[model samples]
Target: MPPPSAPDCYRVPTTPSSGEFRDRGSKFVAVLRPVRSEAEALAVVEEQRLAHPKCNHHCYAYRIGPGTDRWRANDDGEPSGTAGKPILGQIDKEGLSDLIIVVSRYFGGTKLGTSGLITAYREAARLSLLETVLAERVLTSPILLEFGYALMTPVMGALSQLGLEMADQEFTERARIKLEVRQSEREATVKELKAAIAGVYLAEVHDTFVVEGLTVSLPG
Candidate 1:
């Protein structure tokens, strides 16, 4: 386990990589993808397992959130602590979060020494994380607003003025927009936005909804 008090930044790969090799006649193939949370990490692992049903081993690990959510790793059938921990350690070393990595081994006919196993797993994970495209640090906050096309221009303008990061905008009978307000300015900006379009808009906080893309929400 990495020191609990270790620094909080890590890197993760941006793209998936596949490599196949035979050790002593056994076939091994590794597939790695960046993942954000345990749920996402596990989902990818399961998906790959399903995709390669006959593979001998499917091991995975992931780190999510900020320092609050400590890194986690697992080795499916490799040594007890070998596969997952090393992969996760590399993530921590690279200061990465919200990423997942999985390695599949088919038990090559030749046994890779413990050291070989470690290197292969570590290299696979390292390469995967390295492929990722990273963004500068930005705090994200969730917000909901209700408006109509009658006020789209003003609403968008207010969004820019308030420096609120727009996430999702839905258009139907009503315009339902979601914002990822920067944490530092979220409260003040929300207030400012409300005030800016007070009479013209009907915005209110809504239940928390998690969607992909910069922002997304169902039109209200």
Candidate 2:
């Protein structure tokens, strides 16, 4: 079991995957995908709706962040907890996050009792995950770096030496840069930036932000 403390990386599906289940002529289609935020998750649901326009219910569950701290589950008109909860249960059972599972049900003119509905939804979610490739998602933090335009050269030198990349750079009388440092290395990186640019270049550390890496390469 992994420790309860925040982990450096979390498990997630490597790509979108789908599976289908049928019981009593009712068809349930499930798709699992990696999603970073609620907006993305909802967009996926919309896309699924477009794909399965004939489906009756589009139930779903999703979790975000390494800790799986933010999440939502929707039955989408299924009997109260019968659909959404079971799908979410599978996600939590797999110890996965930053992903969403959406199950579309096509009513086959037969009513599945509470137990049957739960079983169908759970099995649908499980089937999609069974075909998925799990991967480790690294954690990262974003820090905003600001300095006088004159200090660009020294700052660039420091970043190049550290093998760091700057993002969202804006130039004016003062220049602003956004940096994403690995969560575990953020403090050290911040210290290094200060040491290299603070006094000599009058660099100012205006703000700091935390974020997860959208993508990180895994060593072979």
- Maximum-lDDT candidate: 2
lDDT of 1 by residue, 57-105 (tens): 7877777766546566778878776678778777777666667777777
Q: What is the TM-score of each candidate against the true structure?
A: 0.59, 0.70
In candidate 2, position 191 carries an lDDT of 59
* TM-score of model number 2: 0.70
lDDT of 2 by residue, 104-217 (tens): 999898998999999999999999999888878877788776667567776787788778997568888677788877788786777566655543332343334211121112
Give lDDT: candidate 1, residue 149. 72
Candidate 2 stretches greater than 4 Å from native: 1-8, 67-69, 144-154, 170-177, 194-220
Clashing pairs in 2: none
**lDDT value for model 2:** 0.81
* Model 1 stretches astray by more than 4 angstroms: 1-28, 68-71, 142-179, 187-220
